[model samples]
Target: MRPLDPRLLRYAAGARWFFAAGAVLAALQTVLTIAFAWSLSQAIVGVVEGRSLAELRTEILVFAGTTIARLVVTWASGSVSIRGAARVKSELRSRLYRAIGRLGPAWSAGRSSAGLTVLGTRGLDALDDYFGKYLPQLILTVIATPVIVAVMFWQDVLSGVFVVVTLPLIPVFMVLIGWATQSVQRQQWDTLSELSGNYLDVLGGLSTLKSFGRAERQLTRIRVVTERYRVATMKVLRTTFLSGFALELGASLSVALVAVGVGMRLVAGDIGFGPALFVLLLAPEAFLPLRNVGTNFHAAAEGVTASEDVFAILDEAADAADATATAVHPGGGPSSAATAPAGLEFHDVGVSYDGTTVLSGVSARFAPGRVGVLTGPSGSGKSSLISTLLGTVAHDGVLTLDGSPLPSGPGERPWLAWSGQRPGLISGTVADNVSLGEASVDPDRLTRALALAQLDGWDADRECGVAGSLLSGGQAQRVAVARAFYRALRPETRVLVLDEPSSALDHETERRLAASITELAAGGLVVIVASHRRRLRDIADVELALTPAVAKR
Candidate 1:
């Protein structure tokens, strides 16, 4: 709600230049306004004093020149503001995306992806009105209002006093109206985000809903959310119209007061006609900037709301980064790439969510060239432990590799490979999915990975459709596992983690996957698998059992 947020300058470099340009243009515009008013007043008074048109040609030409200059300046200001808005929007979107990536999947798990999509797209686009209309007028208000009032005071103290006293009334009314507008605008924004999230959820689960004969029920839910958004939008528009009327009325009456005072003084011969006319002309100019600011503020409120949300996310990412930087290492220093670990070890690691401990005081080590299996009942923290190793979940105790402390987060752990329970595949060919994150797909590695995942002779050119819809449940699961295998085949990858890789496979396919995991361990990789399948535990060189704990809701 601020006229300008300091964080906008911090996040978008273009904003700094925009403010600089706006100030220059605003100052130029103010000077031209004063010049045009004085020139026109002098021309009128000279003609009334019996001077010919040719005798007053200088004042007439000056009036026309200032008018043209003002027009050019206005156009230039608009062009600069538009380009600046585009640059700021692009920068904000890019920074927001990078921050989300750094926060990782664990941080995003509890958030709504559809809401975020709306924020990055439609929400930020609202800033067009803010930068183009509201901010320029704000700059003018700061630069033009004071100077015009000073000119008025120089001409006549009574008119200047009237302006100074009544100018504050517009802002007083503006503050009251702005408070109401902000409340309704924020409600509208939230309802829009809700509507987007609900629609996305229905679309994503449409097949399952149809299978249960409950697809029609989702239509009612969507309709309810859409109606809520529509009502919220109408409320915002209502407030905007009412607030605009209030501002216009206040400005008009204030101008009328100045005009009435000037006319009476001119008739009584207490003030010269030229000075009276000049004071009257400058009266509206003094109030114009403030009035425009109040009117455009409502239009820009939504962008202001969206920017606040963006700043919140950016701040959270920064705080997370700071905490990670100050984290204590077991070895008293971070491990270097030259001192890469030969094994993975957990020394009393624990994980918690909302003050409820899910895994506590668990310790284990899986050496290179060995397969380690984690066995536990549901909600016993099998996946939680895997999350700690993946650097997605914060842990209570130290995690070290070959007696050296591991770096925080997956971005720092290029030597690790993992596949979760979900396929997480995009629309692409099988080869593209298998060789993800690589600059170029290596056909040899792609074929070998698919073969190891028991997908031998599968089409590398086959499409997976959206979220791997073209593939069966078993096929999608294998493709996800193959993605891990493809990464594990790299020379630098030292550890491989799989969370329920065989959940969707039959007994024969599970056996083949177990043999593949054993083969990977034999090739000097530390393979860790979290599953309840007895066959997977049978192939492990080390087995860790987790006991379930009561979780507070």
Candidate 2:
């Protein structure tokens, strides 16, 4: 990991302010350090020379005052660094969330949600040690170490040379130790993410495992993963302790070298007692910042690793944005215009994944005031087509609305409302889930949408619990469909797409949903339903059948 990542400054504006404040504090502390060392040295020498107490009074007070000021500066520096870290973490997290949203469901489908949860929460929290300790010491090292060494040089050339030569040794040892620490720290972080992901997976599918009499096997699996994580953590801790000891030893030896030189000069009368004393005092101060930096780096290594993960995500988002901007649309024009026709058209649209075609050369159109049903066998590209329409997947050919190309970014497709195979319901009241994106719930629309989805007379205030656990499977599915219905109620919504809306419902409820879909189409909206039910296909004003594309060898 870099001593400081440039991406942190680029992504978190607050980090810039933190650096500024830290530098100011470090400079002030350095000045006070010099003042304190000088005053104390002079006072001690004056007493040894048999000077009167009154003569040494000013020197005594100067050192005392400088000591107090140094304490205040240290406290203030810590406070500033902590607050700055909070702001930076907050900013980075917010940006990370936005980037994920932009990447959309397609990008996230291949990633572990549990791992991301760990990263956004506990992983980023590790930065507390980074900004609070490591960065402050680093700034001090840059601003104070050289200044102290220069002062030593001015007083005694031999002592200054010793400092300059030995200071490099601490950094050299730090580099070697840091490499090992980073390798171990990264392993620990990965293990933690894997543990979180596996644990979440086991929980999510515990019911299925129990049904198959295999739940006990999962316990063993989790135990093994837990042990692996424990071992990884121990390795990281071992590396940290060993690296800390190495840095302390190097700093101690360097300070001793300077101390021995000063002691010899004083014995030989080659330097004044006051100058020798001052050099002796400043020698440790010169090494203090560098030594602290090495110690704090290990503590902050985890945060550095997390930041690297965050930067990778941010870079992916940036690259995706660039690709979106430069990509060519098949229709060769801007997105749908306000005056365009109220219908959707597919011009030989195709989709591929990992160089294997899933959809190819399919053409179709659905006009307003029509119920269009897509029927196909498994692996027939039905979901792929919907993904392309939702702007979650890239496709060949063109999808147009009212004769204009459809926008390829999800955020730009505000006119489309959809419900997928998964309920994806959050913990909230029924009304809250239905009117999710609305600024405020419209009571009339909420009641109508629920009624249209065969949820009429159901309490709007019914709790969904976690992932709609409070509702039955069919009810949760309806709630998801109702959410899409709620969105379709908006005047701006032109198309409503539902994937397997009736898969969990009984025959009677499926018939009612089909009638409701027909009613929606009557309102001059293009309604598309992807399903295998014969009743739904019979009610459609149009039907499009898709076949799986042949893979090229």
Candidate 3:
């Protein structure tokens, strides 16, 4: 990716204002720097010519005032740039998170959780250096470099010509060095992602490894991955140092050439002391921004790599959503919702994984005030069918509401609630997770939902440590049930689907959960459950028995 990809600006806010303000500040600072140098040079010449201290008072005051003003301008510029960059980062992170959520199980199945975690956290944080340092300096370089050179030319054309001619060397060296190291930097990013993924996976499966007496074996694998990542990181750092050295060398040589020209002209009595010193001071300033850019490019490179990955995910999600929408609405018109009496219907429904059909030609009907229990063998695609209804995965055949095809987009299924086989819980209070992403929380409704999920005696304010580690497995499962019931508070939600909600419970608890399902259905909600427990199936108003694709054929 380029240092400033257009897609970043499209998603990030306040970039235009940040860059514009940076340019204005750079111009002001450049003018002040030149004036301070001119004043100092004049003061020195005046003092040497037997002038009194009082005679140079004006020059001294000018120098001090410009110095203070320059400092203030720089501080203000940095403050604005930082806030703008933060705003952009925050907005981009939120958008990426929402896009991932919309992609659902399809994305989860295809992506590495550790890789995505790194990209969202440490990867996005890399932009700090890119914005706080590189971007501001980049603007300064563009504005200050040429203007300073032009002023030096006005003072003494020969010295100005030398600076103008040699100044291009810094950027030229930077471009060459950057071109050579781009591939190495990309490799470093990939290595970091791989290492992060491996470490997370190992940590998650550590208990299993211990049980099988393979923990020691996995240690060696972890060490090898870490060493590889360390080597890749070192290579990136070495490249950065080499590039910085080359830029420094080119800039130093250019400044030295300008100094030599100015000194010779001074010796020949062609230029006065004040103008000579001014030209000399301004010569180095010309290359400073470009040099800084090369130095900060290392940070910029990491951010760019991460950004490429982030944008790729966003783009792919959008394409998938578009395709799903097209499939849902084949006539290129909005899909009509099936009317109330029929509730939800599936006709000749099928699902496939890795090109093999999991479920085929399955038909079922679910109506209001009824509970539909989906029962089948282990590989019969029971969960797959529920995921399709919940809009987590795409499906073949027609799923309709009142004989009208269901809408394709994930957001269009707001009226549907799902509690997956694995309960989704984060580290927060019971109420927090129950009301996750909700705009408001109702105490009475919350209490009722908890009761319905069999979560009695649990405090709403109790902390559910990371993934509900603070709660027992059954308690966590009940919390998932509570979350689904809370979502069912919406008047539009006519269908509730629970996938293996009884998996973590005892037989008695499973009976209680089944009773809750029957109660919700009695209250006029269409409840669909995919479960192996007969206790749950016994309460069903309708039972759909599915078979594997081969058996059906």
Say which candidate scores most in TM-score: 2
**RMSD of each candidate relative to the true structure:** 2.7, 1.9, 3.4
Summarize candidate 3's per-residue lDDT along 1-553 as a digit string, tens digits.
4657777777776677777788889889888988888888888889878898899999999989988998998898889777877877787788789888778876578778888999998888888778888888888888888888889889889988888788777778778878866888788888888889888988999999899998899778888888988888888888998898888898899999988888998999988988998888888888898899888888788887887888887787778878876764222221355333467877777776657778777777899889999998998888889877867776777777765677644666777877988878999899999988878888888998898898877799999999999999989999998999888867888889998898999998888878888888887788999988889889988999887775422
Regions more than 4 Å wrong, model 3 = 48-57, 321-341, 347-363, 395-399, 402-405, 412-414, 428-451, 454-465, 549-553
Give candidate 1's TM-score: 0.92
| Candidates 1 and 2 compared by TM-score, better number | 2
Candidate 2 regions off by >4 Å? 330-341, 550-553
Predictions ranked by lDDT, top down?
Answer: 2, 1, 3
Model 1 per-residue lDDT tens digits across residues 321-395: 888888763322324536755688887777777678898778788899999999989989999899887777776
What is residue 258's positional error in candidate 2, in angstroms?
Answer: 0.7
TM-score of model number 3: 0.88
Mark the 10 consecutive residues where model 1 has the least summed lDDT: 328-337
lDDT of 2 by residue, 498-534 (tens): 9999999999999999999999989989999999999
Model 1 misplaced regions, further than 4 Å:
50-57, 327-341, 550-553
The local lDDT score (0 to 100) that residue 5 gets in candidate 1 is: 86
Model 1 clash pairs?
none
